[model samples]
Target: MARAGGKWRNAWRKSQKSNLKLRHTQFDAALHNWLLVEDRKQQRRQKYRSLPHSIIHSFSAISPRDVIVFCARKKHDDVAAMLFLQHGEVATYHVGWSSAHGRQTNAHYALLKHAADHFVRCGVTRLDLGTVDTENAPGLARFKIGSGARVRPLGGTWLRIPGL
Candidate 1:
């Protein structure tokens, strides 16, 4: 956190001011909450494209011991954000989502920082932050880079047929 720049520092401060709290929760509950919020927004004439139910079910079928889920909440216990990470020697961020109010308060920043801290404490050497496609998501790419992660490109893909 000390290495974070002014923007991230300000975001942390903003999250603090909002009285945001992070807690380890069941994945199903967090997903359910996000879906409910999306439903509410759609009813209010706001459009949202949600992930398919099958995806949620597939994720749920994974063993609980293999994944870690955290949910953020404000002072009034309103859901702020949720993060899902797969753990091993190197933890990998699987999914993350934040509410509208969360975006206003930079809840994602706080949640990510917290995740990093937690992984370090658990002796994880590295974290795979997924992709950073600057062309399509410059803001998201910048966010990942700002979090002190370096870009490591993958090598060329290889294909093999059973009987060539």
Candidate 2:
């Protein structure tokens, strides 16, 4: 029954994983942790610091009551964060960034685990994990897949300017 045993082990492992989605201890802490991760990894740091960060300001603005911030901490220091936004039946996997230390600690796995745990309870029937660059971001693509996220080309993103 090696096959059966393997299946059982997998199930057990899945159950042991922590769901960090919307698992923020405090709004401020979550935001702080997010900034730390982004800063350490240079993940969209400039873009965030300028426009999005200014408009969003606080985590409350983006998540309100429907958002979950999952963070991984070490030695009382924030290392990584995964922010999610829920809309109706869809849970959009927003931005996730991690520090160098966080990566060594496999913080993203924890973040993804947490997201899967609480999505259904939050009225999120489907999870939209956004998109990844297969060529430039192969590791990220694999990470998503490893966490049970299937890839599907939802569509392309477009922007328009009112004044041309």
Candidate 3:
């Protein structure tokens, strides 16, 4: 059997070889046109929640360059990847939305490949792929897992009430 992290590393490496072009932009007011167009296109995506401009703006403001807006371009820009970075410590893979054509061409893999390199260059060692609904989103789980991230259950939510 292969080493544990080996497979994930391999997938990431494969993403690098793919010829998909990448553009990294700091999400800012200057991105008005991009934000509008991307939001509009992302809304029509099936089985995905539509992202709003306000939320995008808020995230961008909160993290600045940490909120990396990655777009994978082919002949045209076909897919976008949303990554939230905690500077050098960790970078979270928030979301990745792609058109049908983008998916058909496996643009995400290429995007991630570039992301891994970028993170390393920026001194980041961790990439959190967030939650995966195994039952409802097996494909996503497989994708993340196949990319080399280990799966663990998130800590449960708890509340402490005073004078209860």
Candidate 4:
């Protein structure tokens, strides 16, 4: 029975590995083109809400070296934003969206999928989504979950003793 169980476990592991459908892509020149396209769309929707050009410039500067951009499309329109820590371990610091569109299009989903793939390819075993507010950021939590990330509470900060 133990031998049979071992075989079953091995089979399950192999099946899971085979079923893993993560698409990982490296940052390249094509990303610049994609960003331009996304930026143009944001510009067109300036009447509703306009993201500052500085933000795009900053993203462009950082994305090539220490960040990855994950994007999703809605009706051929892409909407997404993210900045991840590229060294040490994979982690996301600030992630936000325009809220102008792509909410119903699941652009966030595609962004997360790409992020996960990117991290895994970079040999990162974990991707920290940072802290959650629970109330104000429920959608953020849901998006992380849909990306197949396990939610775990972060450890509280340490307090240093006065003369220790």
Candidate 5:
């Protein structure tokens, strides 16, 4: 009877594993479909507009030294914008995206590519893509990953002495 019970336990575990795998597959498919739909919508929007070149130029002019404006063209407008802060000679700090579009024509990728190319030309070795939260923002994480940026943990300060 003990041997029979052990066999039954193993069978149950196998079934559970299969079920988990199926669920994961279904979730992945759903997410992919959602991303596709979103991309299509964004493309349609982009067809009606042009990027605001003057705005970007103005931003660049007003920004302080060591800061550069990063902008991306969209279907109907210029969607994503950010600033890169030059720290000394080697590293560039990403200040975060200020204006982001909701579509998927890979505009963000183009912007990053342009920035990376410009940095390379200017003798900048490293481009910081900013900190990202992976657990709750998986889609954003995926987008960042698609930009060819590696993920790394960022350290933060802790309030150890009750604000002293």
Candidate 6:
């Protein structure tokens, strides 16, 4: 029920001053070396892939900071949520993970927002947010749509392995 409205904006402002800190890093960077490293490590991950990493790497030299991590610090920096994407002409959402505490604190929301802003600054004009299957994952569907993303049909070519 956390729509990107006035209430959410207020919470975002409050969270900035709160214990949670938003970070942007490269895809290859370590998750531990944040503000402070936390002990109790736990998370739930989700992955989506249209092409292999090798394919993406072929286009550009893989560098650091293509990732966004939302860290919540108490005694140490705890990774509340993290998101990774593949970039070309369009930046594609590759994968993401979030902890139970992250869900409670809406870490993914902040993470995605930060990432979108980062991508735009990097000259990326398009960001494909991957699939939104409401029949299976309704919450995820709503989340993506609620972020001002409209549904677009994906166009692609299917080919059989030549030898097969």
Candidate 2 lDDT, 1-164, residue by residue in tens: 13223433454354335232224642354545546446445645433232244323354576676656677777677667776667789877776777776666566666665676677666677888777667767776766655565667766668898996
TM-score of each: 0.72, 0.66, 0.71, 0.51, 0.48, 0.64
Error of 3 at 13 (Å): 7.9
Query: All candidates' lDDT scores?
Result: 0.66, 0.59, 0.66, 0.51, 0.46, 0.56
Q: Please, what's the RMSD in Å of model 2? A: 6.0
Backbone clash count, each prediction separately = 0, 5, 1, 0, 3, 5
Query: For candidate 1, lDDT tens digit of each residue in 2-73?
Result: 666677677777877877888665466455556445445644453434344455446557755445666677
Please provide, for model 6 over 30-124, each residue's C-alpha lDDT reduced to its tens digit, 9 standing for 90 to 100.
Answer: 43333212211211123323344343233334443444343443335454644455455467775455556666666666777777777788888
Q: TM-score winner between 2 and 5, please give it.
A: 2
1-164: candidate 5 lDDT, tens digit per residue: 13223433443344333211110011122323333343345445644222333433343456434556555444444454444655555434333332343133334444455566676877887777666657755655665555556668778867678767
lDDT measured at residue 74 in model 1 versus the true structure, 0 to 100:
78
Report the C-alpha displacement of residue 89, candidate 3, in angstroms: 0.6
- What TM-score does structure 6 among the candidates reach? 0.64
- Models sorted by TM-score, best on top: 1, 3, 2, 6, 4, 5
Q: lDDT tens digits, residues 26-70, model 4?
A: 334455455545555755664323345455456546664555555
Compute the lDDT of residue 129 as modeled in candidate 2: 78
lDDT of 1 at 86: 52
- Candidate 1 wrong stretches, greater than 4 Å: 29-62, 76-79, 156-161
As a whole number from 0 to 100, the lDDT of residue 48 in candidate 1 is: 30
lDDT of 2: 0.59
Best candidate per TM-score, number? 1
